[model samples]
Target: MDKVNNFELGIIGCGNMAKAILSGIFSSGFLKPHQVTAYDVNPETAAATEYEFNIRMAGDLTNLTLNTAKLLVSVKPKDVGAVTDSIKNVFAPGKNTIISIAAGVPAGFYEKKLNAKAPVIRVMPNTPVLVNKGIAVISKGKYADKEDLEFAVKVFAGLGEYVIVDEKLQNAATAISGSGPAYFFLIFKLLVEAACDLGIKIEDANKLVLDTMEGSAEMLKKFNSDAGHLIKMVASPGGTTEAALDIFMKKQLDKIIKAAVNGAFNRAEKIQDKILHGD
Candidate 1:
């Protein structure tokens, strides 16, 4: 399928996450190597990505749309202004979808910067995408339509799981699946540290924590059981698990978690505000 239904993709940044997406899509046969192009401010990076992915090196954004494109802006939020200014000046209007994987900044920011009705799609993908086990949250801009949303889903489906949300809920969704990996990582680290503090060897503690986590996650997926159900199943009336859980509850672990997540959600909001407003 040349251009994957005539949908050439121009990636504006060739970073690690951008490479993860390219790997997933190429592996899934969603887009052939020749159908995508990589552009980066650093020619070295652009050349490296081109050689690695066997994709074309885009001289400019305009070249991507010779056959109509879904230009994927995979840059950092701090660089959005520079990227958007470049695209706004040189990129063609219509016949192309602007898909951004930048966190916190909404599609509106791009549209506003472009100062035109460019079809924009926003997605938040976590680092697990590097391992092909990530989840991405997708949302459409005012100019994006059903077909855009469908294609976006197909684009990210190879990564793992995906969910579509209204643009209004994009940041909230981001606060979870987008920023959620770090939360788990932090908790896992703490568990390991606590176990080691209790005199368990590091290696043994790692095995215990990792095996327990993997099995627990699998149970949630396999049995489709809520976390509460799993907790109840594991914590018998006066068991060790119950004792630990009681201590956690007594320390207001649940409230702390809620507050942490809420803080993340609000920080996401502030990030957007900073993107749209400044400093």
Candidate 2:
């Protein structure tokens, strides 16, 4: 093992996704404790993240890549400029691969900010990444070589599944995966609340929702059955399940959910345009 094939990983921000990657990289033995370094604007957050992961912590972003690095930029969209500004003057071109997990920020922003033809890989990952079950969609900027893009995909695969996507479809990716977790969580909450209304204890309600969801997901995985077929499998004709299905259909559930997702997609586009062009 080229112990450093994992690379001397550097993280520019210690937010949730950053921490999740830190935990995944360390736990998976892809990198040793001394092989990773991180820097965050908040001194306390930087210290806490470092302490938890047992990695080196830099006091500033400029110092983050002092060693040979494969940097992951996990900062917020608005704060990317500041983070990039702090390190742009110091970052080495072609020697490092930069991965950005900020939603709605285009690769062009990074290219202009870095002021160098640095290999930049843009990724959109969901919140489930924290649990090591994330779906990440990635795309390469013009600066990224084939090897750089492959290594970037490998890093994300260490955390979860990854899809090679086109930059133009990023807004759809943001809506489908980045915000999809919240949508599923909302459905889970509603299911649990309904169970509780039927006199199930809160704890039992939670277990029921979790078990049912997990079982359904597992069945889908094994059977390769479409959702409609899966629903039919559970709901016998003219039974209790059919009664509930009737309500869901009467309420236009599918149409409503489609509208909800599209709304999210449109809002993501608006934010990107607003930030990039102030439209």
Candidate 3:
């Protein structure tokens, strides 16, 4: 029998997230295309991915598990059970490590479906991973140890930033980092619209907002201070920025944002409950 750690990395789905991860892995020179294998239920998607990435495609879930020591389960949360069931037999105890990126799916869920000793890691990765700028939060299961978690982190580091969190906090991480990009994008859209409403041309508004956002992000990256501190720095006592900020404070923007974040957090928790209990 092949040693569990001797096999290549395998991905069990070829969706957008899978593609993004593979792209980052290959681009980062972390793994060669041939070192990775992928399987997808959709034949067309598999074939397209094979053609685009020049990586081998597995004939089935079993084939993927047989060839890879580390498996990344990228299917939707609803399909996790079926996918796990199909490949569970191939998973060797204390050998293979399972990493799941399905939203709201817990590591325990996979461990329960597979062998109790199976190592599972749960990850919450955002859409920015498509562009190699994603933030992924990872958590370990009952059997997974520091080594297993580190291996999962290495794989995701190719895509972008990653943080290790307790399994209990995975849902909160999903709400923040996993769903964070959409919130930023929505805010950017509103900012663009507001700019247009203020007499700026649509194209120019988009450019202005995008550039400003990019620069602002860079500032955050360069500075060691927190966002609140940075905002205070920008909004001088009686400046135009302060004027807008004053209105935002009066309107209780912070409360609104907290509520929005809590809404996402609550929804993530509910989804996890539904997946776990079929509620």
Candidate 4:
């Protein structure tokens, strides 16, 4: 058994996202495994995480809160209330800060359940954090100060880039960055399938699609120009790229994407309403 060191940060849920956070923090040398403790509802999961990351496993929610000054509530949005209720008494105002990554859950929800003076930071982070290339949008609660926001930013920065946004804009962020990867992935899958249909080998199709996507992303990053500008740069008059782009434009791909993103945003708002009002 690995001897547990005193922990400064506690994770309330030991899911994939939490594990990604641990990996990023460890890789960045921002925090060691022993300095962090974690808890999960499933004993096996917690034990596996302890062994995999060499971090301590808290006996329960109460134990986790008691052991660390900063607590990350990474449970599902529906489970947030129960987790907050369990640790409300242990959470000390001005002494402890709670950062929540539960989608659609607001900081005020935690503030109402936990100590009013305890700072709460709400974050929406995507799955790409597993590769240390994710984007996180953070929002501060009424009780949270600039210092608290900065502290949360530093922790997330270990995973990737971060932006500070108002709580009202969190749903849009969730729709764009939170669900954006899946959209890109679907397009990649379609492109690969199209290449395969064109008689390319499966492996070659995958490589071609991925390399093209990677190169395009790098070009966009390097040029610091809007995607439309880059598209114009690539598609000359009477060119193959322009021909393909014309088909997409005629099919109203932009409108379809806009509607799909709006669908995600609306669903997020409805979920939050349900969590907040028990609708």
Candidate 5:
């Protein structure tokens, strides 16, 4: 029997990403620890999140919707409608500014579901946010204004870089930044494996590949050069770098990358639970 209390931020889903966001916002000092509460359909989950963050756990969605001035909806796309149904009746039209981090789901879907005229802000943040290095792409719904956008930016700013994009471009943004980390991680993993195959010790391979990846990024930024320019700089004629790069060129790596990114972009658009009002 958790008592209903006014919370500046009420979390609809208290999962890993939600916890990451909590950590970031706490570090940023934008919202006090006492100003946020977590709500989950599974009471045990709410209790667990509450224990970790020392925030109150809401016993029900109605109480959370009615009491919290702002809310963060971090549920899965398929579960969004159920959460929306439970809150729409109690949701405060002008008071609550809802921010969603659900992948693939657009802000418009939430707005249509609520029909309460509350502002909806959609965010796509990668898992890197767990380590405070994530990039979040945010897009505002029709009802969201500068104030709502400002609040959204401040929350994620503590984690990593955030860019505001048009709702139309959200899927492409998701493809590039949201799914981009996995692509880089896979490449790094393969590089480590390839180094091991070349007879390097596992420990040395791990360090070498990781350090090279980090240093390469730094070099690009420090030199104000694109990756193509760096490639040319590294692969001197008839050198080992040139030999390896020639193999990659023969494999059409650039085309392979473009196809992979394009696939992700198309998948992003199809993954949302987009239910219109009349449909």
Candidate 6:
């Protein structure tokens, strides 16, 4: 357990995202229980997690991580409105770095609401964090210094790969990674369902999908060839694979993929501008 020096880790809203982070933190052994504090609206969740992690849980946000360590706000976006008002009086501006994982809630929004000069780092982490295979995209706010950004990076890195992008790229990253797991899972589900419809047993089809997907990914790791070349190699001319490719091409699958991605981007923008703002 190589514990990192300086700053206790604190988490607000000990929900799924918080739990995922706690698991990562404990497994990494980079921080100790005494160094972590949490508060949640759900008393049961707060109590259970506190006991399980052997960490302190504050019943109120006033006595929670905000009063002690660097804070991570993992509350849902809609619930952020309540949270902002609740923590306003308790925030210690210079002493704590605030990291928020709520989607569509900009760091500017928090700065304005909290009325503090605390460094804020906005993070968009996907549900895959639950399995510690998440992809997180981070963007720094006005007051967040390099040290603060580095600290946020270290925390999220324990969950999975993380990238720090410019603020302008945050929305795109959110669309691609934040919502990407659902898109990929939908594709996997369709493939498995189609296989079962084609007379393959459902269980076998699922296993086949899982194994083939993993094996194909492994192939990419082992081969230096680009995806196009690897795909070409697998798709022999006038063979079943080629026939399938021809059908996909005829159906403009590439165009469909692009359209799907674009749709997600457009929706993400709408979520930020319209839903979050009531515009």
Candidate with best TM-score: 3
* Candidate achieving higher lDDT, 1 or 3: 3
Task: Please identify model 3 stretches exceeding 4 Å from their true place.
Answer: 1-6
Q: Residue 258: error of model 4 in Å?
A: 0.8
Name model 1 segments beyond 4 Å from true: 1-7, 65-68
lDDT of each: 0.84, 0.82, 0.87, 0.88, 0.86, 0.81
Error of 5 at 11 (Å): 0.8
Top lDDT model = 4
Number of backbone-clashing residue pairs for each candidate, in the order shown: 0, 0, 0, 0, 0, 0
Better candidate by lDDT, 3 or 4: 4
Clash pairs (backbone) in predicted model 1:
none
**Model 3 TM-score (2 dp):** 0.95
Q: Which prediction has more favorable lDDT, 1 or 2?
A: 1
In angstroms, how far off is 177's CA in candidate 5?
1.1
The Cα error of candidate 4 at residue 184, in Å, is 0.5
TM-score of each: 0.94, 0.91, 0.95, 0.94, 0.93, 0.92
Query: By summed lDDT, which 10 consecutive residues of candidate 6 come out lowest?
Result: 1-10
Q: Which ten residues in a row have the lowest lDDT in candidate 4?
A: 1-10
Model 3, span 1-279: residue lDDT tens: 745553468898899999998888888787898788889999999999999999889898887887788899999878889998898888886768889999998876777788878888888888888888888998888888888888788888988899988899998887788788888999999999999999999999999999999998998888864788889888888899999988999999999988988999999888988887775
What's the best-to-worst order under lDDT? 4, 3, 5, 1, 2, 6
lDDT of 6 at 93: 69
Which digits, one per residue and each the tens of the lDDT, describe model 2 over residues 70-140?
78989888887787778777877666768888888877777777755777888998888889999999999
**Candidate 2 TM-score, true structure as reference:** 0.91
Clashing pairs in 3: none
